[model samples]
Structure formats: structure tokens, C-alpha cells
Target chain A: MREEKPGPLWLRLYALTVYLFLYTPIVVLVLFSFNDSRRNSSWEGFTTRWYVTLWHNELLMRALLNSLKVACLATFLSTVLGTMAALALSRYPFRGREAVGALAYLPMMVPEIVMGIALLTFFIKVGIQLSIVTVILAHVAFSVGYVTVTVRTRLAGMKGNLEEAAADLGATPWQTFWLVTFPRILPGIMSGALLAFTLSFDDFVITFFTAGIGATTLPLKIYSMLKFGVTPEVNAISTIMLGFTIGLLALWSRLESDPKSLGR
Target chain B: MKRFLAWALVLPFVLYNLTFVIFPLFTVLYQSMFTIDAEYNVSQQASLDNFKAAFSAANLEVMWRSARYALTTTAACLLLGYPLAYFIAVYGGRLRSQLLILVVLPFWTSYLIRTFAWTTLLQKEGVINAVLLKLHLISQPLQMLNTDFSVILGLTYGFLPFATLPIYVSLENQDRSLVEAAADLGATPVQAFWKVVFPLSLPGVISASLITFVPAMGDFVSAEILGSPETQMIGNLIQQQFLALFNWPMGSALSLVLMLLMVTSMALYMGLAGERDA
Candidate 1:
């Protein structure tokens, strides 16, 4: 390998500027969360009052709980279904395989608004109420694609010999899966679950359409708060949500180190 | 038996998607063909009225504005993201993963919060104005919020990572010897980049453009938060029709139009890119 040459000074400066631009909003959001004043125009003395208020705000708290509930359920369902689909695709060469793959990918390709309203219309037509159940269904539908992609990638990378060797040692199929296959794909499944949870937790547009009265999630609550106007309480909640998402992503990166996987 | 088991394993996923994804989209298409009455009851009779209304002058203006904003956002993201991606791929040796993480970190956060952060910055008495005023740069605060500029800026900011990561992947995967070979052939650095580096990254550029453009086209959050009613996009229009106006049929028609446009543009872009490769 050749020794890497340094980039031009101008290029370095330009990259730095882009980084600053990317981070400034996040930094500002975090900073003003602790500001004493209600207005975000200027920084006042530091205070944790907004955080305190956020803790006591019943609607916001309910929304947070609802987000967690929806994310957990959606993540579990999508992960299982996606992993199964990935396994079936990788393990068997069946007719209509390509069609099933395309069907799985359809949710990701369609715009969120299209899917949101379509689901809304479908639910109303089917006589199903718009509630957290609908939100979970929508999330699982969208997230199945991500999980399938991730697990399929992992399956593609695995050596088929390992599972064969396990079976050759007098192990049953279920035993081979449990002792050999499951462990290898666990990281992929976990990462997919993490991705699903984050997507569900932070979703706004889909949740906005699917959520009925009293079924607000954090993003929906944040949207309403944002529409109401700027406040330090909103900043505090946003900061917490940001922290949670970053923490999840950090965990995900540890499981799936390749940045390319994120693109899929 | 194994094939049957595989089919069984895949059944739930297939059923879920058929029930939720495919069926609902078909429902949207079906619903788009019908009409609604003044009492918000969808009529049994199917007609093309919703499609016509979707193409009305006012609706077309919103669609055109959406396309223009999406295009502009795509262009801006390319301009800003390409260089940063290029820098990271070429110059970032040890810190490459860290830098990539920074690029994606903001993306992982809730987009609503990120746009709201911009509201705090771009408001009339917001941080930017306060700083500018403090420095005596301007006599009065510029009306930065609730404008075309803010909405577009917000879109670009929200989608920059989408543009960057793909471009970076393409650049990183390129064989360095190609550039070296170009250099050895007595080509200037600029010539080498344009002829070798940039051409090789076309796939990434195309992917970046599609991902960014499609989302930006469908995005209403930035416009809803940062733009006024005058600057609303097709997304906001669809949202209003369903949620505010109680016109599900119109919303369905508008959504189909948006999807049709996206598919058509994607096909056109891929066709052009394929021709270029050929």
C-alpha cells in the first residue's frame, strides 16, 4: 500500500466547515436545553428547569411511553419476520423468490407519506381504529425491509460449511441452527432490531397519520410542541431523544462496523 | 420437506406485506378513482374527478414547486456533500470511521428535532440574527424564517448525509492505482480527477441524487416548520387534504401522482446513467 498523502489545505478547511455546519444545530439544541430562559433567541444562565418540567409534563411522558411501547413491539415483530424471510431467501431457491424480494423492498421504496396515507385509508376502510396498534403495524411493515437486508447480508457472508459441519456431527437440524447458525446471525438480528426501534421511535410522518387521539408518540408530541412554538422544554426533550438515538447507534456500530450496511 | 419449511418460514412476512404494503397501495389506487361528497362520504361511483383536481392549476403549482425544491436540494447536497465525501475517502486514513460516524450521527437523530433546531437559528430574533445584530452586521434582523431559503436549507441539511455516504462508498471502493496511472500518464491533477475519479463515482452520485431527491420531494416537515402556507409542498398538501380538509380521495390522488413522478424520474435518471456508462 502506498503512503497516504495529505489533502489540500483548502479541502481540509472545506471539510471542517461542513462538519461545523452538521454539528452546529445539534450543539445549539443541546446547549439551549439547559438555558434558563423560555426564549431560544439568546442564552441565559444555566438551569435544569426544562428537564424537570419535561419529566412532569404528562402528555409528553405519555407520548414517550407510547413511543417505547410501539418501538419495542414493532422491533420484535419485524426482526423475527425479517430474519425468517432472509433465511428462507438465502437457504432455498424457490420460484417467485425475486417477486417476494421486490415485495419486501416495496415499503422502503415508496415514500413515507404515500404509505402513511395508504395505511390510514386501509385501516379506516377495514374498520380498524387508528391507534398504537396501527402505528406498530406500519412500523413493522416499513422496518421489515431493513431487517431483511441486514440479515441477508450476514447470511451471504456466512460460510455454508459451518452449518453442514454441525449437522455432520450427529446434530439435528434444530440443534445445528441453535448452536451454529443462530449465533452467527445474532449480531445482524440485533442490529436490525436496533435500527427498527430507532426508526419507530423517531418516526413522525407515518405516526402522525396513523396515530389517533391519545396515541401520540414522542416525535408526534415534538411536532405538536414545535408547531406550538419554541420552548426550552422542547429542547430538553429533544436533547434526551437525541442522546437515546445516538446511544443506540453507537451500540449498532459496534455490532455492524461497516458503514456501507447503513446505506442499505 | 425443507422447501416446505422454507416456504412456511417466509409465509408470515409475505402475508404481512401483502396485507399491509401491497394491499394498501392498491387501495390508494382504487380510492383515487372515486369521489367524495360534501359530507365526507366516499361515493360508490368511480370517476376521474380526483385525478383532475390533483392536476388543477393550484395543485400543479405545488407539485411543480415540490419538484423544483427537490431538484435544488439535490443540487445543493451534491455540491456540498461531494467534496466532503471526497475529502474523507481520500485523506481520512485513520479517522475515516470516526468522520463517517459524525456525518451519520445527526442523521440518526430525529429529523423533527434537527429542523426545529434550525427554527431556533433562523427565527427573526433567533441565534443567527442575535449574533449578526450583536456584531452590527445589519441594522435589522432579516426575515430568515418562514421562507423558501429556510425550507430549502433545512432540506439540504437534513439530507446531506444521504448524499455523502453513497458518494464516499463509491470513492473508497475505487482502485487507487487508477488515479496513479492517470498521474503517470502525464495528466494534470484536475484532468485526472475529472476523467478518472469523478467518472468512477458516478454510481454513487446517482444513488445520492435519488435517495436525497425522493425524500426531499416527499418531505413536508421542513416546509411545514420552516415555510409558510405559501411555500407548502405536495407533502403538506396531501397532509392537509387527509388530516385537515378531510378529503381522502384527493389525498390519495395526490399521493399517486407523487409516486408516479418519483418512479418516472428514477427511470429517466437510471436510463441516462446507463447510457453514460455505455
Candidate 2:
């Protein structure tokens, strides 16, 4: 074996710079959330008063709750539908399979603005009133794509004969899926669902277009608050939302510890 | 009967896509193919006038600028991210998963908040300027915010993780024996990297390009939050046409043209990509 030479210090320093580039903005956001001054530029003293202020802000709180509701509903529906889509692609030898898969994946591949405006036109044409329901529909439209991709990858990696083995054991088709297939695929499904929840929760463009009067999600709320100027309270809410996202990610990590699951 | 039953599972989703995806896309196409008149009424006389307007000199300039911005961001991400991905993949050894998790955990945060954070970092009194001043690097705080520089920096920062993960996967999965063989044949490490490692990692690089480029092209959040009107891209234009102008026909037309441009570029890239694999 060739003895490896010690690497140059520049490359290691470059890597350190890359990490700083990725991390510093977020670190700044989090740091300023505790800054006692109304302006976050200079630190006067540290306090969690922004957190207390966040607690009392009715509009931001309501928008956050609305976001959670939309995210939960979108995640649930997309998981079910996307699992079916993944299963239909993986388990069956159907014609036009590639075409259908492409169709399903197009939402994720298309630009967010295109996806947003196109849906806005469709809803307006069909006379569907813009509301939180419409927002959920929009979120589900894209979240389904993420779920299908994740679940489909997991399904592809599985041994295809497990269902048949269950059938050989005298289990009915439905029973086979529930007892054998479901358990095997549950980790993929859960991770895909968690991903769906996060994407839906973080969605801005689609929600902005589809949301009519009185259907503002958290991002829309943030955008408006930002129109005025950046403040410590915005940072506090953002830090809190980031905390929620990390919490979801932790839950997903727990479910995805199985090596068989695609650790995406 | 079995085949039919198999397809039955996909029926609901097919219906859902028809309502949301297919119908919405058709709406954009149809809206783009016609013109709206004085009374806000849709006439059945279809023409490419809206498309012509969409491709007007000014809009085309915006499109070109967006392409340039995306290209710059993609290049920046690749340059910055490739080494980190390499470090994590080759040097990480026992700490690979932990290092990867550290990279990915930041991605779970909201993109808007991250972009907004850049406004704080690049503004005249922001972190970078403040630090630069403290060091006596320059007599003045540089005008970093609301510039092309800030927008691109924000985009590169935002999408760096996307570029890193794919490249790391490619690097990690690369066959070490090929490099070993190259070394055994008396090739230097640099030559081995060029001849073996880079060629093998092209697929990941292409994917990284796709993910980074596509989003950067469509990104308005950074431009809106961190850029002046002079630095606006195609996405910001679409947003303005939709929200500010209330010009649905023009907005739809712009959207169609944007989609066309994206799809054409992607298809072209995929063709080249497929050729690369062969």
C-alpha cells in the first residue's frame, strides 16, 4: 500500500471556510434572536424577551398554527397517495409506467414559480375559491412528489418475493400486505411522510399564489413582516420554526436508523 | 383482472394529478395562447401575442440575467462544496455519518429564513462589514447588500448543501481499488484524481448542477430580500406580474416561456448526460 502523504493545510482551511459559509448566517439569526436591542446589528445584552414577545404575537402564532394544520393534513394525504403511486410503479408491470412516473415527478422538477402560477390559473379557471384548503391542495401537489421518490427508492431495494412468501404461508393478499409488506416498508413510508411534512411546512411560493384573502401561511406572514424591516422578533420566530423543523428531523432520524432505509 | 386491480391502486393519485398538475399546466398553456381585453374577459381568439410579449427585449434580458446568476451560483457551490464533500467522503472514515448529518441538518431549516439571514450578514452594518471594519481591512464598510454580489452569495450559501450531498455520495461510493491501481502503475495522486476519481464522479456533479441550477434559476426570495430592482431575475418578474400588475395573461405567458426554457435546457442536459453514461 502506498503511504499517504499528509494533506496540504490550505484544503483543510478551505473546508473550514465552506462550513463557515454554510453555518454563519443561521448562527447569526439564532444569535440575534436573543439580542436585547430591538435592532439586531449590535448586541446590547442577551435576553429571551424576544421569545416572550413571540408568545404574545397573535398574528404570527395564528399563522404558525395554520401552517402546522396544513402541513399535517398535506403530509398525511401525500403519504397515502404517494405510497400507492410508489407501490403501483414497483409492484406492477403496467404499460405507460415510465410516463406515469414522469408525470408524478414533474412537480418536483419544475420551477417553483411555474408550479405556483400554473396552479393559481387552474384554481381561478375552475372557480375554486382560494383558502387554506387550496393551500393544502397545493402543498400536497408537490409533497406527493417527494414522498413517491423516497418510498419508491426503498421499494426498489426490497426483495420482491416477500409478498409471495406471505401468500405461500396461506395469508390472504390484504393480510399479506398488512403483516409482511407494511412492516418492511413502514420506515420508508415514515421518512417520506416526515419529508412531506417539512416541505409542506416550509412552502412559500405555492402557498403565496394559491392563498387568497385570509389564508396566510407562516412564510407569507414572514414576507410581510420583512417588507417593513428585519427585527429581533422575526429572528425569534424563525429560530422557533427552525427548532420545530429540527425536532421533526430528529423524529425522522430515529425512524430511519435502519440501514435498509435510504438514509436520504 | 389482477392487472386492473393493480392499476386501481393508482387511480386516486392519477385523479389528483389530473386536477392539480395536468389541469394547472394546461391553464398556463391556454392562458399564454390568448390575450385578455379591456373588460377582463377571456376571448376565444387564440394567438401567440402573449408569448411574443413574454419574450420581449426586457423580459428576455431578465431571463438572460437569471441564467447568468444561476450559472454563477452553480459554479460557486461546486467550487466550495466539492472539497468539503471530498473531505467528508474520503477522510471521514469512521465519522462519515456524523459528518454527513451535520451537513444535512442545516438543510432542514426554512430556506427563506436562511436567505433573510444573509441580509443581516451583508448589510452595511451587518456582520461581515462589522468584522471587516474591526480588522482595519478597509477604511469603509463595503456596499455588499442589495448587489449582485450579495444575491449570488446568498444563493451559493443556500444551495451549497444540495451540491455537497450528491458529490459526497459519488465520492464515497467510488472504487478505491481503481485509485490504488493507478498509484501502482506509478501515476501520481493528482493524475489518479484526474484520470479516475473525477471521471467517476461526473454523474454526481451533473446531478449537483441540476439541483443547484434549477432552484437558483427559479429563486426570487434571495433577489427580493437581498437585491435591488436592478438585480431582479425572471422569478421576481413573474411575482411582480402576478401580484403587482394583476396581469394574469402576461404572467401566464411569462410562466410558460420560463417553463419552456427550463424544460428545453433540462432535456438538453439529460441528453448530454445520457450520452456521458454511454
Candidate 3:
């Protein structure tokens, strides 16, 4: 029976209603970005004034730049570390290999708050002042886990003979990796990097605890702003952020559709 | 050559992970049980006082509220996600990827941005009320922001994709012939679905629930941004112990409790999913 059971109209209606409910808030944020007034709840005349204000907000721009910096650094480090870890674990068997794999996965499985506080305590105990550097270190810890998992799945499916052939042809292990294995698994690495970059950029809780003074990322900036009140300026910033995220997501999904294309 | 390179490649990765991830976790357990002061001094005696403080009436109330809120959010996501997953799987065709992207996009944005977006939409005289009032559907704006409703809405929206993707992956992989055979045997669409499709998709549903629910339980940002003081969750309490009150012991204890809850539930979820698959 290849036929789908037709759910009741009410069931479909309920689903549609839930979707509307889901999109409604996002739609409101995008719409109100043009509100002239400073307040979020009360709309005056529609204006681009808030967007203009957002454009002029130097502090927010700086925080955004800082976030970009940390995300890039974290992504780069984790991608290299994680891919190498995945390769080492997947390609060769060693004593305690499964145990090592479990350790690699631990960072991701633990709660953010626990990790955050743990990092906080570590930093304080070690007398390392909280800074942007700490945040990057903290992010890389978890980003490495995600990157390893993503890359491991790809490595597991990959045939090993290709690299063996390269080695039999007199290529060193490192040379074989760079010549054959690297190119084949590059897509997984790239996807992992993309995911790590996003996770680091958007991270709130871990960043909150690990980021000491002078390390205000955009999320932290917005969080601090919330303490005072919500404003149209925040809405304008959020709308732009949403657009950027969704646009990236569209591209990611498009790439994700073809499993072979991931190798690209 | 292979063995030498393997150890060379893996050593740094392994060592760093142990020093950072594994070590810190143990440190958290130790910190939770004992007190530390400004000079980084650890007390000689350990006590369960920290756990007691964390589970005190006031803090326990927040923990309970957090569980309630997380459960509600998980329920909402599953309910919304299943149909959407089905629609995309069976009906979406060419637009499937794009629709899936829509579900996942928000997760990339700064969580602050998404939660703030909710506040914008849910506040009194916000766009929702404006539209409703303009339509004359209501004379008064609905009270929305800083309420449980806004918190739940935000949590559900933010986590919906986590719920949908696993379910969609499984649904997409499902063999269509069984459903066809059921229909050929004169089974109604509902019967075919309940008897054929739903059972096969149970694993996806189980995993999706686990993915969304576990994280939602520990989520502090959504509650802080969307909920009022009264609606603050366990996450907020944990934050208080670390940031506000500077109580490391209490923070550690709370973190352990949160970890325990998540582990037990996740294990249960995986167990159930395994049974269903079998």
C-alpha cells in the first residue's frame, strides 16, 4: 500500500495553524524593521529610520566584526583538528580507539551551561583572563566534535583502496593523504567548517560564560541590550541577521541535496 | 609507517581533548561538591550543601517550570514538525529542499536575534495585535510578550527543524510499496498510514523528540529573552548561581542535576527508538 493515509481536514488545519504560528513572529520582526518609532510594540509611520540607525551603530558593527573573527578562527582550527581526528580514528584501528571516539563526542553531548561554567572555572583557576581568545578556545572545543562527527560519517563510507593505491605508487602517507584522501573528503570538511562557523557565531550561553571583559560578540551585545529594553533598532538588526542566516541556509540545503555533490 | 603516522597524527588531538573536555568535566563534579573562594582556594571539606541550595524551594520551582516549559516546547515542535515533515516528504517534490531550508535557517542566526524577533511580534500593540485589531477581530490587543505563550512559541519555532529533519530523513527513506500494497488490499488511506507509514516513521519521531527536548530543557536564552521573571527556567537559575550570586558550588550542583535529567531521558529515548526499529 503505497498510498498515504489522508488525515482529517482538522489535522491538516492544525498543522497549517502551527506553521502560521511559527512564521508569525519572524514576519513581525522583518515588518517592524521599517518602523519609525523607537518602540517595538507601538508603530508610528513606516520608515527606514531604524535601518539607518542600525547602519550608524558603530558598536554593533564592531561586535559583529569580532564575532566574525572568532567564528573564522574557531572554524579553521576545529576543521583541521576534527578532520585529522576523524582520519586517524577511521583509517586505522588502535587500542582504545572506541574510547577515543567517545571522548571526541563528549564535548557535543554535554550541556552548554556545564561546559561554559567548566571553562569559566578553568580559566579562573589557571589565571587566564577572559577574552576573545578564550571564547575561540571554548568554541573550538565543541566545534571540533561536530566537525569530527560529520567528517567521520563521510570517511566511513569512503573506500580505502584509493589511498592505498597512492601509497603503493610510492607516495608517503602524508603525500597520499594530500593527493587522494584530502580531495575526496574535502566536502565533508567544508560542510563541517560551515556548521562550526555558524555554531560559533550564534552561540549564546557558552560565549556568555567564557567571554570575559572586552569580548562582546554580537549575541552578547544584543543580550545586554535586552536588559534595558527592546527597540526598533534591535528589530532592524535582527531582520538583517535573519535574512543572512536564511540565505546561507538556502545555499546549504541546495548543496546538501546531492550526496555526491558534497564531495565537491 | 602507518602505525607511526597514526600515533603521530592522533596524539595531539587525543591529548588536547583529554586536557580540555574530559578534565573540565571532572573539575565541574569536584567544584560542585566543594566550595572555592576568591583566592582560588578549595575547602578541605565537601558537602551536599550546594545540591541542597540548588534544589531549595525557590530554585526547585524554577527547575520544575523549566521542565514544564521544555516539555511543552517539545510537544509543540513534534506536533508541528510531523505534518510538515509529511507534507515535504510526499507533496514537496522540487520545493522540498527550499522548504527544509526555511525550517533550518533560524538555527544559524544568533539565538538572541530570533528570540528578540519573538518579543517584537508578541508584545501588546505588536504586529499581531495590530493586524487583529485592524481586522476588528479584537477590540483589545492580546497580552503576549513576557508570558509563557511567547516563551513556548519561541522555543517551538527555534527547535522545529531539529524535530523535522530526522523525521523527514526517515520518511524519505521509507519504502512506498508497503503503503501501496495496503491500499491495493482495500485499506483506507488512514488505515494504510496508521498501519504502515506511522510505525516505520516511529524511529525518526523518537530521535527528533530527543534532539529537540534535551536541548530545550537546558535552554536559558529563550526563557531569558521571551519569558518574564516568573517564567524563568532552570537555565536561568544556573546562570544566577554563576553570574549573579557568584556561587560556584551551587552552579556545579545544578549543572550536574541538569546533566542527569538529560542523560536519563536521552537514554530512554534511544532505547525506545531502538525497540521501535526492531
Candidate 4:
């Protein structure tokens, strides 16, 4: 007997069509990245020359490295701060708890342009020069909310029994968390860190306002390249970036699903 | 012990938010009110002159265009995204996570690159037109680029995943028995959906609208690459003021207005959502 499911065959076709629409432009870009000639719309033939050219582009490479550096620092700082905030929110009841929670969640709500300009104004008012440090600070500022939300969900799913049992066994509060609580929420922390890293890596608008002349990131570089004309070199760089993002997301989803990694 | 531990852990982030997010927003308001000359001389009293100029006929038209484009794009996303989200949540079975990830993969790519790809796909002599020509559908290529159509298309394409994810979450969490109960009571499939599924999934739709509209209203990338000058949005105007024209007061004023518009809409949505969820 055919399974008369609520979701029908028509739904599947519709879903696949939507997926095709979403993926086609990316496939086009990846295809043209290897074109033997410099036409964006035509396939002259296959060649890896664009990849080689991209490899040799010093300015873009520097930008790529800067993105990595910022992502790493921002991810680390945000994970630590956000994890602490999450632990606090879940562990205690206090006055103005709702207010604090709302305040912490504001970054997730505000538009990027607004957030970008607000920080830009703050930096200029305080006379702090824009540079790589400023970029990292801005990235961390916005990304902490992402981390807190992720970690808070993890902490919510957990039982207080484990930590209480640890304390009942004469373990110190710090030791109990380090041994029992921390390990259980580690997956959430890792996922949050991964999210922050990816967000910082691909950031353009916020960086546009906060970054100085010498501290351009990869997206900023690509934006400038688009100004001249779309070229195969940009295509090659985009392909590599697309691959990197996919790999990271795969790792993140893996951590998310595995209970053992979540200290089961 | 627990209360002390909690506050200690939370205080640093609160401080950081105040210094970074809150203070800067206040500065935007302050910056909007003052006029500065060539030598950086500051005006003492607050003035609405900057706001007045920003709301002048020319700039107000751009703001109106931006909001209208955002609304159209949000509607397009909902029309296209809701069905896909329903399909994935209902029929994806073991493939649910995989398919959801597919929706997110495009979102993970660089925004600039994503927009750049559309230029190739939609340009006058681009792939779509080339294919159409080869198919003998049209003699001349369609002028797809440098138009509002292309801008809306790019914005929708780039943002479909944002629309899908929230709706998918709500759909996935819904009790299937509600729909089944409706079906068992002699309701048609379309009736079951309209009466049961759509009402249940509305919170997701509301959130999807919030995220989509906020970013779409502030987007300049789609405008700069896909739209002509006549269709340029307030974002482009703000960018011009800050970057090209060096008119800081006007730019700040414009930013605050956009921010106010976004906040009002968000608050309205939240108030409605709170009542519904309650």
C-alpha cells in the first residue's frame, strides 16, 4: 500500500525546485572559477589557472589571514564570556533577571547597520583608532549573544542532579563545575564558538565601519574586487571560502548531534 | 553561593554590552543633533536641522522605496519559503537535518559573493538570457539587470533560508495529530492546512518576517549591484552620506530614523506575539 502521507509528492517537487533556485547561482560561480577564458557566462574550457593566480595574490592572502586572526580571537573571547553569562542565567534567580536577559539579547535583535554605526560612533567618540583590534572587539561585541543563546539552551536541557551530587560528595563548587557541569555543556560551547568564528570570518558591513585601511578582511577584499569587475580570481577565492564554510558547518552539526561529545 | 556566582559570571557581559552596544546607540542620537563645521566646531544646543534635511523630499523618497522593497521581498520569501519548510518538516523523515543544512549552506557563504553570482545569472547577456535565446523563447535578451526586479530577486534569493529555518522549526515541533484529527473529521487537506497548520505556524511566520524585513530594509548590496540609481534605497543614501559626502550629521540622523523604524516594527510584532503565545 502506498503511504498516504500528509506531505505529498507535489511538496517534494516544490522543495527541490526551491533548493535548485538557491544553489544554482553558487554552482555557476564555482563552474566559471575554472574557465579557461575570462568570460563569466561562457565556458571556454576547464583550467585551474585561476586557482594558481588566486594563490599568488598577496593582498587577498593577507586579507584572508587577517580574517582568520580576527575570527580566532573573537571566537575565543566570545565563547568564554558567553559561557559565563549562560551559566549565570541558568544557575540563579535574581532581581532584574528579565531585564538583564533582554539587554543581553539586544545584539541579536538590532540590524547590522544599526549595530555597526553605533559601534562606529562609540569608537570615534572615544577616539579609539580603527584597526585589527577594533575589528576583533566589534566582532566579539555582536557575537556574544549567539554564544549565550546556544549555551543557554544546552544548560537548560541538563539536570541539576549531576552538579548537586558532585557537591554532595564534598567536591568544591568550582571543582564540581569543572568536572561535571563543564563537560556536559562543552558541545554547546564548541557550537557557539564555531558560529562566532564563521560569523566573524564572513563579516563585511560591521567590518566596513570598524576596520582601518590596513586591516581589511576577505569579504572587504571581495567587495573592492567587485568594484573593478567580477573576475575568475574572485571566483576561485569564493569557491575555497564556500568549501571551508561547508566543512566547518559539518563539524558543528556533528558536535551538535553526538551525545557522547555532550558528556553523556 | 549560587546568587553570588551568577552575578559574578554575568557582570562582565553586562558591562561590555553597556559600553559597546548601549553607549554607541546613545551616541547615534547625540551625533544626530549636532552640527560640526570644517574645523570640527560643535554646536552646543540640540537641533533637528539634520533630521529635517534627511527627511527632505529627495531622501524621504529613498526611505519609502527601501521600506516598500523590503515588504515585497518579505512577502515573496513567505510565499516561496513556507511550502518548502512544510515539506521538509513533514516528509524529510531521516533526511530532515540534511535538508535543513542544505537550506543553510547558501546562508553560510559570503554575502557579497552570493550577490555577485546573481549579477552573472541575471545580467543582460547572462546565463538566463543566453539559455532563453538558445531556446528560441525570445529574439532579444531581456534587460534583467539594473532594475528593481533584479534587486528584489537577489534579496529574496539570498534570504530564503532565513525565512525557511524559523518556519521549519515551528513545523517540525508541531503535533501531527492536530492535522490528522482535522482530516479524520472529513476536512479536506486544504481545509486542514488553512484551519490548523497555518494558524499554528503563524508565530514562525512573524519571526521570519521580523528577521527578513530588518535586514532587507538595511541592505545596500542588492541595490548597488542589481538596482539602478533611481531605485536606490535609504541604505545607499546613508552610505553615501557617511563615506562619500562626509556629512556626518545627516548620516547619523538618517541612521537613527532607520533604527527607529525597525524598532517600532519589532516592538509591534513582539507585543502581538506575546499576546498570542500567552
- The reply for model 2, stretches above 4 Å from the true place, is A1-7, A259-264, B38-44, B267-278
Interface Cα RMSD in Å, per prediction: 0.9, 1.7, 2.6, 1.7
Backbone clashes (count) for model 3: 8
Question: Which has the greatest DockQ?
Answer: 1
Off by over 4 Å in 1: A258-264
Residue B274 in model 1: shift from native, Å? 3.1
What does candidate 3's lDDT look like per residue over B1-278, in tens digits? 66776777677678778767777788889888897677757678998777777778988788788778888988988888998888777766677777676676656676677777777667786677888999999999999888888888778877887898999998999987788899999999899999999988988888888888888888888878888898887778888888997877778889999998888878887887788677
Q: Candidate 2's C-alpha lDDT?
A: 0.87
User: By TM-score, how accurate is candidate 4?
Assistant: 0.95
Order of the predicted models by DockQ, top scorer first: 1, 4, 2, 3
lDDT by residue (A9-112, candidate 1, tens digit) is: 99999999999999999999899999989888787899999998988899999999999999999999999999999998888888788988887788888999
DockQ of 1: 0.79
Each candidate's DockQ: 0.79, 0.64, 0.53, 0.69
Docking class of 4: medium
Tell me the tens digit of each residue's lDDT in model 2 across B1-278: 65786688787788888889988988888887778777777668899888888888988889998889998999998998888898877777667788788788878788889899988888888888888999999889999989989889889878888889999999999988899899999999899999899989998999998889988988888899999998999899989988888778888888777777777777888899899789
In candidate 4 chain A, where is summed lDDT lowest over 10 consecutive residues?
A1-10
Quote each prediction's TM-score. Answer: 0.97, 0.95, 0.91, 0.95
lDDT string for model 4 (A1-264, tens) is 335455677887888899999999999999989999886878899999999998899999999999999999999999998999988888788776777778768987777777787788789889999899999999999999899888888888888998889989999998998988988888899999999888888888889889987899999999899888778888899889888888888888888888466564
